[model samples]
Target chain A: SYYEKVGFRGVEEKKSLEILLKENPLDLEKLSTFSQRFPLPSMYRIHVWKVLLGILPPHSDSHALVGGYRKEQYNDILEALHVMRYVNCSTPFTDVCLRMFQLESQVLPRCSETTGPDEENEDFLSIARSMEEIVDDPIDCYWLIKCFVHQFHAKFGDSIPHLPKSLEHYLSQEEPRLLRHLKNTDALAQLPYGLWFRRCFAGCLPESSLCRVWDKVISGSCKVLVFVALEILLSYNNVLLGISRPEGVAKLLCNIPQENTDAIVTKAIDSWHKYCGTPMHAV
Target chain B: FLEDVKCQAKAELQSSDGRYQAQRRITQLLQTELLQLYSRVETEAPAGTASGSPPGGRADSYP
Candidate 1:
């Protein structure tokens, strides 16, 4: 009975997605709008992500060929990197890349043929812990992370494109008092936004809410991240205001328990609608 | 080919049958809660001023 009542909505959403997927030259605009509005059915999420992220082309006919080509390219890159890692330990790659490469080797059965015993990547568990449940297949996860890095410029470092400055801009407009308090206490400067922006809130939010926020990001622009970040700070404004120490503020903001998903994301989406066309092009 | 992929995925979704019943239940429950929250927020908020937070004192009104 509960399933009959609640499952209908998800089923309807799935049907709509199916219709969109069946379109010949798939109407990307409509699909984006669809993804922006409704929850993506779990069954079709990877394919929809592939299409939206341009890993698979828009033309339905090209799906198989392009998917094959991209997977091969991914494997070839891994094999090359595997060789290089052995030859030169100084080769530069992000921790995410090294972790994903090691994870891929473990997951793909054939990888044992080429991939040598990499020093265990214990660091990825801390970084991408949430990804374990959301995406089962490491190959899909690898490509998704690669495309995310390309699309979102998700490099973890001091220089996130539009960071505390854009965050300050939104804060001034939405929560001026909170902004003033953060500045007065020097709390804003200490927030770990680089990690948040770099990973696109992968570990911060639960899988469902993260997926919803990411749907908006994929549909619209990376600017959506700013709105999500702002909404999050605003959500915890009261807690933040009472704290004067930078460490306390940073600690509290970093670990928002995975509750209130709808309210946060809904407000973020509202913010996106209101301010999307403005000059927030720091991406 | 995309159609075929979709068909295969749909079939997989069906084939799981009762195996994924527990996961599906959790997802449905979460989805229902989310829909309820969406409608409540939608009804309370005004027509425009989307950038402004909801009129409530708390930002998210999580309670």
Candidate 2:
């Protein structure tokens, strides 16, 4: 009886009712009427309707069953479906919402003025927050660092080709505190090589004359720090990839005590040489 | 053979234009897709300490 009122033909069975809906979609008036009567539809029924709407041939169907909804309404429906445990069914709708959001954002006015010192500080804080969120997952950190490097490239242009140096200058100027924080947290020890490269080097350097400046800055102290950071990063990678124990690295590090920073620099250079000479295929 | 050469030249010109368009489209798609993917993950991921648990836990450890 209610089915008929909603433009669904069958009177007896729900399956017959579903068949009628499939064959003949309800008009807007009938849909509103049904919504008024039923109030909230079952998740399963909503998912079924979504699938039908997605796959139905364009321009052939008589009734525009779900045609007039806005992007936000569609997003709300998908979110509702997700909350109701219909995640698998909600992906297409989610994708549509994502696309719509992208389109809308692209059309919005761009902020063109150069960010002042305070704004830059705020940006650094935001970046720090993002870094903190991703610290535990090396894979995620790798991509996040890539994004940061890209942002630096966009801001400073291609004055520096070396990604690591560009990042070092950017970080040193924008958020020296982040570098200090990272060192204090021993985050370099836990990061993978790509992420470590991104964070420690790329986040720190400037875009101007990086190659010449980089060599100049690689003094004994900086060299020692870089070596320790690289070792930690490489060891983390080895652990993650099930590579053999970095015994060679350990032996090299053992030769240099923690206090002899100059010796650490020499040992680090030697260690890098030895590691680089190892068969590339082995890595 | 001359006609074939003309056709080939025409096709090459079309292909060159098509390739440029395709490359531009791919670049746009990649930029948009990567941004969307990053934002989606950022929104869905737990903030602060909640994300501190390693992804998929210790079972996901490399060794």
Residue A9 shift from truth in candidate 2, angstroms:
16
- Which digits, one per residue and each the tens of the lDDT, describe model 1 over residues A2-81? 87866987787788789888987677777777877666777887788777776666667766756665566555554444
Candidate 2 wrongly placed segments (more than 4 Å)? A1-19, A25-28, A39-44, A48-102, A105-283, B1-63
Clashes of each: 0, 12
> What TM-score fits each model?
0.61, 0.19
lDDT of 2 by residue, B1-63 (tens): 999998998898789768766865775676566556645655788456475442223222211
Regions of model 1 farther than 4 Å from truth: A1-13, A79-132, A154-160, A277-283, B1-63
Residues B1-63, candidate 1, lDDT per residue (tens digit)? 778677545533442332244234334434444555565676777557593654344423543
**Model 1 Cα displacement at A174 (Å)?**
2.7
Best by TM-score: 1
RMSD of each: 23.9, 28.9
